[model samples]
Target: MSDGIPLIPVIPQALREAAHRGTLIPFVGAGASRLAGCPTWAQLADGALMACITANKFNHGQMEQIRHLSPRMKLSIARAIESEHALTIDYEKLINPFDGYQNNAVGHRVYRSLGKLSKTFVTTNYDAWLDTEILDPPLSVSTDSPVQDTVATPRVRRRIANVEDFTPANLNQENCVFHIHGSLVDPAGMVMTTRDYIRRYANDRGSDDPTRENRTLTFLEVLFQHKTVLFVGYGLEDLEILEYVIQKARQQFPSERPQARHFMLQGYFAHEYELMRSLTQYYAQCDIELIPFRRDQRDWGQLTEVLEAFAEAMPARAPLELQVQMEMESYLEP
Candidate 1:
C-alpha cells in the first residue's frame, strides 16, 4: 500500500500496526493550524510586537529589526513591547482573527483519515480547529480552566481544566481532546514568554519541590511511555518533551535498553539530504522513526495526499471497548 506513494520512500510498519490497533496517539503541533491559515509562531510573535509598536507610535526601525529575529528569540521583542507600553499584549486578542473558523479542509481531512482509530488527540496549538474537525459540537479540555464531573448527562463535547480532571475512568470513557498548552479561551494560561516556559516546565525547580506541580510534564511522560505517539505538525524543535520521554525510558529500563519507538511526519525537499540525515540520526537516538514527505513547491496539496494515502493503508478499526482497555493498561503499567 505504501508503494503507491513514490514521494515517501518508506513508512514504518510499526506505525501502521499501531494506527490499525487504535494505539496511535496523535501529538499535534502548530504546523497543523498553519495549514488552516493561522500564522506560524514567528509570524504570530512578530505581528503582535508590530501592533504594539504601531499603537504606541514607536519607531518602525525597531519593528523591522525584531521581525527578522527567530520565533524563540522574539520573546525578547514581546518583553520590549511590554516594557514600552507598560502593558502586556493579550495573545488571545492577537489570535482573534483566527477565531470562529470552525472548518478547514486540511483539518477535516486529517480527522476523516484517522477515523475511529484514535480515541484521544493532544495538541500544543491554542486554536479550536481540532474541535471543529474531530469533536462533535467541539468539546475540549484546557490546562487553564477547571472542570467538575458531576452526576449529570454527559454533553457531546466537554473541556477539562487541568490534569486533576483527567481520571483513568474519564480518559477511558470516550474520545477526548487535550490542550496541553493554554487555549484561546484563556489567554493567561498561554505559554508565550520565556518565563512562562520556565515555570511550566520547571527549568530551575527541584523535582522534590513541595510547592510546585508540573502536571503537564508528568502527563506527557506517562503518555509517551505507553502510547505509540505519532507526531503531526511538530518540527522536533522542542527538546523538553523529548527529554522527558528519554529520562523516563532510561529510568524504567536501566539494564536492558528497550526501544521506545515513536513516529514523526516531516516535510522536506530533495536537496536537503544533510538536513534530513541529521534529523534522522538525532531522532534515532531518541528511538523515533522519522517519515519524510517529499514536498514539491508547486504542489500545495502534497501533504494532504500523503495523509490520505496513510489513511487508506491503515487496517480496519478495532472495537471501542478493546481500544479503551489497551490504552488503560498503559496508565496502570508499573
Candidate 2:
C-alpha cells in the first residue's frame, strides 16, 4: 500500500526515511477530522448563519443572498452579527453535531497512525479527534472514577500547545500537538473568519503586541526549514498560508530542491493525472511535492491505509502505554 500503486517508490521511501529519523511532521487539516463526523468550513459558516437567523440578526432572505459566498466571508458576517447582537454561537456543537463523534473508528485509526508517524503534529482544525482519549485506549484509574479517567487521559503524548506557544521548548516535547488555528479548548480564539485569518497570520511588524509579531510566520519558517512535512487531508483549496510559507522557504533556503522536503497526499482519479502536470510544476516551484493517491471513488476513504503504511514502514514500535499494558498482562495470571 505504501510503495507501488498510488505512491511511487521514491515518495514512500522518502517518507520512511523521515519517519525513522523522527523528523516527519504531519500537517493535518479538516478532512482528517471530517472522517470522525466533524463539519466542514461550509457547515460551520452555515451554523453561524443559523445562529444569526435565530437571533433575528439575519433573515432567510439575507441567507439566500449570501449563500453563494465563501465560508470565510460568511463567518466574517457571522462575527459581525455576534458583535452587533451580543449572541454567542457555540462552535464546538457545530463542529460535532453528532455526539460522541470523537469515538469514530476511522478517526481513531487515523490518529493512531499519525501518532506512530511523528512525535510532533500540527493542525488547523478545532476538533479533539487527534488528541482526545475518548477514541483512544483508556487509561487505568481508581474504579470509582471511570469517567474522570476517560476525560483526563489523552491518546497521543499529553501536551496541547497553541500557536503562540509554538516555542523551541514546546516543539521539542515528545508528542506535543501544535494547534496553529486554535482548538475547541478555546472557542473564542479559533481562527474561523477571513478577518480572523488576517489577524492570526498577518505580519504586523509595528504592533503593540511585541510577543506576537511575526510569531506564526517564524513558526512556519521553523517547520519548513527543520522538519520533513507531509501535508495530509488538505485540498489545496486554501492556498494562502501554504503558498506563502513555501515561497518564503524557497528564498530563505536555496538549494537544488529545497522544496523537495515537503509532500502533500492528494487524492485524484487516474484520468485527472494528465491534467495536474502544470499544478505539479507550480507546487515544485513552491518547494512542495504531491504524493498523488488514486481514488476509486469521490471520497477519500483510503487515506487511513496510506497513513498506516507510513507508520508501518518505520521500525516496529508500540505506544508506551500499550507496551506497559502488554508487559503487565503477561506477568499476571490470565
Candidate 3:
C-alpha cells in the first residue's frame, strides 16, 4: 500500500506508514544537525586538532596533513584520552562545542518534533538541546525547584534521574524524554569521555546500583517493545553503543517472535549497503527492517516532504484522527 501521493516519495513504505500512525519513534543522531551548518564527525576530529594546537597540547602539523583516520584509529584516539593527560584536554576541547550544538535551531526542531510525535525518547547526545527544546521554560531537575509539572500541556519533558528512574510510568508519559548520556548543564551526568563510555557499556550487566546501571539497555528495551523506531542522528559508529545494543538485544530476545521495525536515515550511499548488511547481522536475533535514505544534497527537504506526506496519509485512527482536520485548520485558521 502507498500513500496515493506523488509529492512524497514512499522510499520506505513501512516507515512511512508507521510515521503516520505515530508509532514511528525518531532516534536523532549527529547527521541530523549537519544540514544546519553544524560540524560532522570528521569536522569534529579537525576541531580536536585545532583544540590541541590552541591549548599547546600537540604539534598542529602532526594532524594537519591527515584528512581522515580509520574507524579503529578514531576509537584509539578516544581510548588514548584516558591516560594521555594532554590528549584528555584535547578530547574535552573537541567535545565541548560538539556538545554545544544542542542549543542550535536544528537541535531545537529535532526535539520539538519529538515532543510532537514519539511517546518517549532516548538521546545519546550529551547536550541539553533536546531537553531545552521540549522542557517548557526549561527547568533543570538539579535546580532548586527540581520538577515542573507539564501534565496539562500538549508536551511534557522530564529528566531521568538515573537508571532506576526508567520505569514504565516515566517512559510512557504523554511526552517524555530521557537523556541516556546525560546533559551538558549537568556535568556530573554528562558521558562524553572515553572512560565514561567504557565504564558504562563495559559494566552493562544488570546492576543493583541505580546510578551505575546501564540505562541504554533499559531504553532499548522500551524501544524494542515499541512497533517502530525512527533513528535520527545515530550513525551506529560508537563501539560501546553498537556492541552493547547488539549483544543485549540478542540476549533479551533469544527468539525471533517479538520483532520491532527499525528506521535510519542514511546520509552516505557508498556505506549504505555495507552498513545495512552489518546491522542485519548485528540485530540478527532481533527482527528489524532497515530503512536507508539517500540524500545527495544535505537539504533534507526531500525527507521532510516525504514525512509530511506520510503524516498526511495516516489512517484516521485514534492518535492521528485529527491530522487532516489540523491540516485544514492550518490552511484556514490564519
Cα lDDT computed for each candidate against the true fold: 0.61, 0.69, 0.51
TM-score of 1: 0.75
| Per-residue error (Å), model 3, residue 45 | 3.7
Q: What lDDT is reached at residue 318 by model 2?
A: 23
Question: In candidate 1, which residue ranges exceed 4 Å CA deviation?
Answer: 1-5, 8-10, 57-59, 76-93, 96-100, 114-117, 134-157, 161-163, 166-173, 203-213, 236-260, 297-300, 315-334
Q: Please, what is the TM-score per model?
A: 0.75, 0.80, 0.62
Q: Write the per-residue lDDT of candidate 3 for residues 1-334, one digit (tens) a residue.
A: 1222133334467765665665555665555445434566666656655555665655656664554674334434533533365344333344445454443444444444444545556666544445533433444566566574331222335666375676544544545567766654464555645566665555444566776656566556656654476666556564356556545744655654544567654343433556556764655434554444445443454455444343445421222545434433533442
* Clash count of each predicted structure: 3, 1, 9
Candidate number with greatest lDDT: 2
Supply candidate 2's per-residue lDDT for 268: 68
lDDT of 2 by residue, 1-334 (tens): 3232363223567766666666677898887877767888898899989988987889999999999999989998998888888889887789877774444566667777677677777888887776643234566666875643233245545536466586644554576778888888888888888788777767654467886566666577657755678888887565776775565434434554542388887776666666555567777766677777767653577777776676666632222444334434533543
lDDT of 2 at 27: 90
Tens digits of per-residue lDDT, candidate 1, 1-334, equal: 2232236445688877777666676777777666656787877877777767767745677777666676766865676567666766666656646443543545555555543346566777877655433422233377786653222222233444355553445444335667777687775566677666556665322356744545655566556655677787767556565665455534534464332368878777666656777887888877677787767652434656666677677643432567667767766776
